[model samples]
Target: MYCRNCGNEVSEKAIMCVACGTPPLAGNRYCPNCKAETSPDAGICIRCGVGLINTSNHSEFDWLTTLLLCLFLGTFGIHRFYTKSIGIGIVQLLTLGGCGLWTLIDFIMIVVGNFRDGNGKVVVNKQRA
Candidate 1:
């Protein structure tokens, strides 16, 4: 494999690139299959026809933390605030979580991994990269 950030050769199992000091798949500058320079917006490598990994969509929010916040502070929209959804957070806060119904629904969504961040990406269960 190759480092997507630096186009350097790397082990497939390697978590971080030695040359770039970033996760091997954490970038879009190069194709991991052929080490060819890739356009930032390209979804697939023109040279290798491999699907490009989209690191940007990776969630920055922790699932467990969001779940806890939803369970305890959801009435105040703390989880939405943590996920950077300030507009919704404010609305939720002002409405008191839609009279608590919205808060309950959000808590269920978090528990079932259906909640998303401000970017519309699913909240990740793992630690941030």
Candidate 2:
């Protein structure tokens, strides 16, 4: 993978670019897959056609409902179910949310607005329609 901000080569599991101090996939200035320059508003890499996934994008799930479910029934993976993550929800249920560790991590992620839904879109705080 490459840093989208600086086009610098980075490890696949890298959290941020060592050279630019930016999250690997957090920028649209370059393609993380191909290291090619890209427009900020471009959806995909014109060269490699790789989709530039952005965390700022919204999901269909509502933030308030998801937070409420996780707070109330997180151990049961109710939040996962509400987010349409059926497979992980089952796993979470069977494992009691990884013996609570997974649930705790998920709670933190959700509270920080960093949790992604089943479709990979960030579950952001937004007003209901």
Candidate 3:
């Protein structure tokens, strides 16, 4: 992969670009997939035909916190709220977590690391609360 900000080659798992001191996907000046120069407003890379996504602003939600919320306050949809799933949270809140069945399923999903946030990004597996 390439850093979108500086067109520098970077590892796929790199959090930030070493050359530019910025998140690897932060800029639209270059294509992260092919290192091709791209327009700032372009949505997809012309050379590689890959969608350009700016993931620099994405927040890494803690997996442990979500698990704890689901275990302790899932009846109130607290875990859904923490994951920014407000609509589902409201539904869970009104239904009392589908009479506790939905909460149990959510607990299992979180434990198995299949839970996702509002943006469909997986929760970070950090031990922090």
Top model by lDDT, which number?
A: 1
Q: In model 2, how large is the Cα lDDT of residue 47? A: 96
lDDT of 1 at 127: 46
| Sort by lDDT, top down from the best | 1, 2, 3
lDDT of each residue in 1-129, candidate 2, tens digit only:
988888899999999889999878776688888888999768888999998856435567889988888888888999999999999999999999899999999989988888989987778886531
Clashes of 2: 0
Report, for every candidate in turn, its global Cα lDDT versus the true structure. 0.86, 0.85, 0.84
lDDT of 2: 0.85
Q: For model 3, how does the per-residue alpha-carbon lDDT over 43-116 read when each residue is reduced to its tens digit?
A: 78899899985553233677888999999999999999999999999999999999999999999988876787
Q: Is candidate 2 or candidate 3 better by lDDT?
A: 2
The C-alpha RMSD in Å for every predicted model, in order, reads 3.1, 11.9, 5.3
Give candidate 3 regions above 4 Å deviation: 4-6, 10-15, 18-21, 25-33, 36-59, 126-129
Instruction: Give stretches of model 1 more than 4 Å off.
Output: 36-47, 53-56, 127-129
- Among these predictions, the greatest TM-score belongs to 1
- Report clash pairs, candidate 2: none
